[model samples]
Target: MLRYRILKLRGDCLLSLFLLTLIFGLILRIISLCRETFNHEPLSKAPGGDVEPFSLLLIVLGHSRPSSLQRLLNSLSKVEWLHSRVDLRIWIDRGSPRDSLRVAKGFIWSHGSKIVRIRKVHYGLLKSWLQAWPLWDRHDYALILEDDLEIHPQVYQAFRYLTSKIGSRDVDGVIFQRLQDIPCGSFVHFASSWAPVFSRRVFHDFVGWYNARRTCVPGFQPFVPGHDKTYNHWLRERRDVWSPWLRRYLYEKGTVFLYVGSLGMVHNHHERGSHQTEAPAFFVHRKIWPKVEWNRIQECVLQNSPVFECNNTQDGVQCGPVDGDRRALLRRGIKGFLSDKLWICGAPRAV
Candidate 1:
């Protein structure tokens, strides 16, 4: 009888162990399913049916103030035209503060935004840009903006007009913001990294040159002190290279960089963020115009001005009038018309 009891006890123990193992495996499977859903779940469907996607890659430092990032995200969300057309991705550098990550998570939850948090190491401005170039593959066009910028409402409209009107091969990219010295509505050969719209082809060519030189490291190019300088150097070096194809595309074909002569499409808030020692002086030129003035500018550029074109020259493409002589007249007319219609003194500063 005792022997029979022992055999029954052993069977019961074995059955219990088997059941526990099955339950543990089921729990693990459930956890894995949850993880897969979180990672691959679709946030929102593309706004329009059967339309291609455009991407806006906003690069932000991990240590940047959350408030600044929040403000920028809020401004971007306000752009109604970007609702369905643009896929927003916030690229956070490695070693970013937890607070910054929290802010990014909030945006992701609220706006159905995507996040790419770099792991292992921090990539400064130069390397960060190179890391982002691959995104062009998934998008029809890509616009790169820093964290401290507030885009104008008409930004998407301007980009669409430029992309369709100016074939991607004829131009390098369109600058959404202009320097204080650059005239409104002028096409220049120089490329500015701040808020520029890039085509896949141009992006490929630019990356090709960088890869050939192997200047992927931040400080490797000793003379290239900053991102703008690096691009300027690339243009100059490519211009000087003996390759006939380079010359033809840059000079002969006049593949010049384009700029909008209307009010700026983005305002540089110059918040004390990454790479800045202190808040830089907020020049009036960098400020975005009020909505009324901005609308007027957009109307003139989209309707009144002719599409700007440039030809490649031996000395590189020269900056010239976008619409021949009418450009100046139009600029004068827009300024005078707006000045008379609205008081310029008390316009609210762009956020």
Candidate 2:
């Protein structure tokens, strides 16, 4: 009887082991099938098994302070690009320090391609900042950066997201500004050459409008709701200044410059020979992240331009004046940042 009981126990153990093995094999097979069906090609990839990344021109303007320029270039070199290719165009104004020229000319860009433009005559800051990026057929978007500041590693990521999400047609371009009132994210009337991104259409139109306004538009009048004495004075007096006219353009045409770097992407060193001498609390607060929390940036994008020309001014212009309901830019709409037209690579992947 005992022998019979022992044989029964052995049979039961064998039956349990066989069942466990069969279940484990089934799980492995199911997992492999899922991976084969789902993980073949991610939606982020471009077609033809080659990711044709988005292209833009990084027009780096430098004239002096080799250290500042080098720091900025190094920061740019360390940019974490996901699917964007940046072609570098370094424009050195004439009469620049030889050290600065050496730093720019000697630097090697590994990403896409590079072109260094050394002007015959000094273009100065205004012309260098304004005209460094022309209506080049080679590229549609241009990010004009100064050598006085160093950008965060994820600066490209912010630019990528903002360039893709154009909330309104009247958006002049994306700018990297940190406002005093709305610290997180908001649009502004100010055309800050500080770290502004301009599209081909906006820049093309701006060139014509700027020429006309600066030439024909008489008497630098105060345009902002409050006392605009400083800006108006700068427009009239400062010939080498460019941002004043850009501010005028947005003010008159009622366009908005998208501000995504409200949390601070640029660390302005305010080096010698730079325009910005007295760095404000806003500009100095250069808080950068080691690894960018994309979700936080997405929230900031959604929080963009709650009001028209959402600056520190007192106008309180509502976004109703603009084209669409920008507040509808919840997570439900965008799968990811698309092209300026929101067409290419804007849709969801197939189920």
Top of the candidates by TM-score: 2
Give the runs in model 2 whose Cα sits over 4 Å from its true position: 1-54, 165-171, 183-185, 215-227, 274-290, 303-305, 308-351
lDDT (CA) for every model shown?
Answer: 0.50, 0.60
Identify the runs in model 1 with alpha carbons over 4 angstroms from their true place: 1-63, 108-113, 135-137, 168-171, 180-184, 215-255, 280-289, 292-351
Instruction: Give the TM-score of each candidate.
Output: 0.56, 0.66
**Pairs that collide, model 2:** none
Candidate with top lDDT is 2
TM-score of candidate 1 against the unseen true structure: 0.56
Please, what are the lDDT tens digits per residue for candidate 2 over residues 1-351?
Answer: 999999999999999999999999999977754443223222233212333234567889987667777878888888875545567778888888888889998999876567777889988876776687655434556778888777778877666655455433444477675554553456555556566777667776666765654455454332333325545555466545666556544544455556675657776666666465454312323335467676667676554455434433335222223344433322212322221222332232110
* Tens-digit lDDT string for candidate 1 (13-84): 999999999999999976754443233233222222223223333334333555666666666666545343
Worst 10 residues of 1 by lDDT: 342-351
